[model samples]
Target: MILEIAQLQVKPEQSADFEAAFAQAQRIIAAMPGYLGHELQRCVEQAGHYMLLVRWRTLDDHQVGFRQSAQYQEWRALLHHFYDPFPTVLHYEQVAL
Candidate 1:
């Protein structure tokens, strides 16, 4: 499985709106193919920072299957404006401990 981590920096005073939008946006991603699960974590110390962790069956499932789909555009529209700059998304595979 692949884990996609997005570091999101939302605009100041927009956390409420961002979270509200994300509530709707999360459903869009959850319905996509290869979607395993996800979590949205808000930083206690930093009011406008968040961590979004998404699990996928494969890298392409997220990078290609989801990002390239029309649903992505909806996802973008629902939550993109709240971002100050933009979220940085990175994917990782579990390593043996």
Candidate 2:
């Protein structure tokens, strides 16, 4: 499985709107192929910061299957505007240890 982590820093006054938009946007990602589950977490000290964790069956399932699909455009439209400088997303695999 692959784990996608995005560190999002939303615009200062737009956190509420961002969360509302994300509520709708989450459905789009959940419907994609190889999607397992996801979580959107807000930072306690940083008012406008959030972390998004998504689970997929493979890296391509997220990078190629989802990001390259039309649904990604919809996802981008719904949530991209709230980001401050854009988030950097990274993927990881579980370590046996």
For each candidate in the order shown, give its overall lDDT on alpha carbons. 0.95, 0.97
Residue 18 of model 2, lDDT score: 96
**Per-residue lDDT of 87 in model 1:** 84
lDDT for residue 67 in candidate 1, whole number 0-100: 95
Q: Give one digit per residue, the lDDT tens place, for model 2 in 1-97.
A: 9999999999979999999999999999999999999999999999899999999999999999999999999999999999988999999999995
Q: Each prediction's TM-score against the native?
A: 0.97, 0.97
Pairs that clash in candidate 1: none
lDDT of 1 at 2: 97
**Which ranges of candidate 1 are over 4 A from the true structure?**
none
What's model 2's lDDT at 36?
Answer: 99
Question: Model 1 Cα RMSD, Å?
Answer: 0.8
Candidate 2 runs further than 4 Å off:
none
Q: Which candidate is the best by TM-score?
A: 2
